[model samples]
Target: MAAHFPINHHLRPLYRLLSALAGLYMLVFGVVGFVQTSGAEFFTRDEAEWVLGLRTNPAFSLLSLVAGVVVLGANLIGRNVAHHINQLAGVVLTVVGMFSLAVMQTEANVLAFSMVNVIVTFILAAVTGIASLYDRVGSLTAARAEEAHRHSARVA
Candidate 1:
């Protein structure tokens, strides 16, 4: 599996920038949601409360803030740490999205997740996962050799 992933990919900077942007978006969304849902029950499932076009509650807002900070911090850290964090966040977000989807209409929707929230979660997950794939750090020599190997393998 490690062999299948590229090392020191040329597009790493772009992916990192995208990931950082996603984190920033999340941070802003969380803050706005937190402010909008203030004084409401932490886990209230009120559909009337929305932020950035997505339903939210205090609990969800707090969670989003934490997640955003973690992602942003990882991106700033860069290298293997960012890669690992992005991968983990992707999996976690996917699971959260799936769970939210499953409980969308029921009373268990503590997050007050709307359909759009699920869609956004999946999109963010994909972005973070893709970013992780190309965020590896390595020597240029090793990268060149690995690229050559991959090229040869493709031709064969």
Candidate 2:
């Protein structure tokens, strides 16, 4: 079998922890959304009922819960997969945030997205995505250097 790179870098554990925390935040927010809205609507723009400044409804809250579960799961799936998960989330979230910004004023946004939502989402996406990308690249580089050093030592 071909050699596989292990996620042994210092940042791996930190990344996992961050992901878990983010997941927890999402789960909590989702639950709060449900409690506050009383299941009266699937989507709403009533900022008065906003959770953390983002318009939410039953569907949106559910989506948050689902996302939380997935992120938490990713953290437990080992380093390699976790790195990829971060990357994927970064791209997806960034796109979603930008899209939400674009449609924030329109009634088509089912999530009742607003400026606060867009800003926060973008921050999350950028930070997670960039950090993951950096970690992956640095880890791989270090691994490669170590491998080369070992190979040269063995040949010598």
lDDT of each: 0.88, 0.70
Instruction: After the best TM-score superposition of candidate 2, give how far the Cα of residue 84 lies from its true spot, in angstroms.
Output: 1.7
lDDT of 2 by residue, 1-156 (tens): 343333355666776677667766677777887777774667766632688666677777777777767766776665556677777878888998988888888887878776887887887677667546533433667777855754664433
Q: Taking the tens digit of each residue's C-alpha lDDT, what string does model 1 give over 42-139?
A: 99986438788788899998899999999988999898888999999899999999999999999899898989999999999999988998998888
In order of appearance, the predictions have TM-scores of 0.90, 0.75
Candidate 1 Cα errors over 4 Å, as ranges: 1-3, 152-156
Local distance difference test, candidate 2 = 0.70
Runs of candidate 2 with Cα error greater than 4 angstroms are 1-7, 46-48, 134-142, 145-156
